[model samples]
Target: MSRPQQVLASYRSLLRATRIAFDGDHRVFMAARQQVRQGYETGRTELTSEPEHYDEIDKRLEHASGVALLLRSNIVQGQLMHRKANEEPLSTGDHGIASQSDESVYKLRIHKHTELGDNDAVKGGKTSLAGTAKKIKWSNIDE
Candidate 1:
């Protein structure tokens, strides 16, 4: 594909990633969109002006693609919980929006893009700080 096409694809990927990452958070979504646009707009001239800068342009494109992947896979939105877990469960309104009477807990929005890893490392129970507690010095005041 041509360089221009590649650049456009990168821009679209970033926008879509941000949408997925910040679905309900309008402020953050707009901010991220602005940043992506600004980054591309600022670099457009320098990327096309010099032939030697093709390498730089390629690097930027790769970086943008990586950012999109990271956002899509690692980022997650959270739902606000108003009441305690022990309390009654929240009621979904007619519009399907949960009321935010309080700001205590957040329920993570896990989707297919969210990366899930095995618990092998956690189950291993290996510890480098095993003897850390024994290193503390205790002095008696009676002395």
Candidate 2:
């Protein structure tokens, strides 16, 4: 595809990814869309002014593609669920941080493209170099 076509495709992909990632959060969705628009506008001006720098344009395009992929696969939002009065509150951690059970329950907005895995990790839940996390018990959101 031509450079212009590639740029348009990248812009569309970024918008679509943001839409998927921030479905229920209007503020976040608008912010992400605005950022994407600004970035593309800046890139467009640069590319038009310096058509000789094909390498820079390609790098920017690659970065845009990566951002879209990250949005689709990694961005997950959560909605707070009402707390039940009957349930006992869990103990707070040493730093006074409330446990997940003690806090309001959250229903995660996990889309089909969101990454899924177990909670096992080498340290602090960081995934291994192989890029696979421990198995996590989660159900996907049906859109």
Candidate 3:
């Protein structure tokens, strides 16, 4: 089993690291400290001889450190650095009217649509609006 002194040292180290990284927030510092203490306390009665247990904790610490570093860098610049090239040109085509042809063209140049269309006027006769229209009276329905 790992020595009690080693366990206590690790618990304090974890708290210190977390507290420093999140010093600006009072709540975060206290929460991190409490969490570290609770974690060590939970395993206080159990043995710490397993290599995997310590390995998992080490990985968690490394991840937390990485996150802190990234946040610090972001706060300093006020913007995140993307992995891709800056201002990369995207593939785009010039705006133009579309046509149903299989061939591709920048512009479709048809002067007229068809021989007859909606603009040709009503074929039957002139339509009446106000003279033939009737006003509807609303009625209440019983529930």
Candidate 4:
């Protein structure tokens, strides 16, 4: 309809796209983690033992990591956009309320990204700890 309304709609669409991207990235990370665990358990010592498997898992993990970084950057940008939108008061029209809603959605998306980052960090930490424990056990056996 109006300029403000169009901006609001575009913001809404970007927010939705960001959310979907985040979800897909999260799934990719989970799958990669699972594959790593399976590989370790199945006694695949060499990275080239199953070249295709290793490559797929590596690519997925890399993509997930990149997406996570992108999401963090997007959160910052979204906050800036929300702040800009708030500073400029909307006129009384169809765009007015939509602009406000857009700000709210942006804030919500920022919160979601923060939460997702925390979750990913926790999962990665746990995986690291498990791997360290396994190494320690093997070292002890060798000694």
Tens-place lDDT per residue, model 2, 69-94, is: 99998887866556677877644322
Q: Write candidate 4's Cα lDDT for 75-122 as tens digits.
A: 432222243553665433311112345554332222223322345545
Q: Write the per-residue lDDT of candidate 1 for residues 49-142, one digit (tens) a residue.
A: 4678889989999999999999997786767666665776565432222444454655565555555444553477744323322231213100
Query: What would the TM-score be for candidate 3 when compared with the true structure?
Result: 0.34
Ranking 2 against 4 by lDDT, winner? 2
Candidate 4, which ten residues in sequence have the lowest lDDT sum? 134-143
- Clashes counted in candidate 4 amount to 0
lDDT by candidate, in order shown? 0.72, 0.74, 0.42, 0.39
Report the Cα RMSD per candidate: 15.1, 6.3, 28.4, 20.9
Q: Is candidate 2 or candidate 4 better by TM-score?
A: 2
Could you tell which candidate, 1 or 3, scores higher by TM-score?
1
Using TM-score as the measure, which candidate wins? 2
C-alpha TM-score for every candidate: 0.70, 0.74, 0.34, 0.23
Off by over 4 Å in 4: 1-49, 76-143
lDDT of 3 at 95: 22
Residues 1-143, model 3: lDDT tens digits: 34445555555566655544444457766886777667666665443557756765555545545544443322211111233344433222232123322333233211111111232234545452223322322132100
Candidate 2 scores a C-alpha RMSD against the true structure in Å of 6.3
Residue runs of model 3 more than 4 Å from their true location after superposition: 48-143
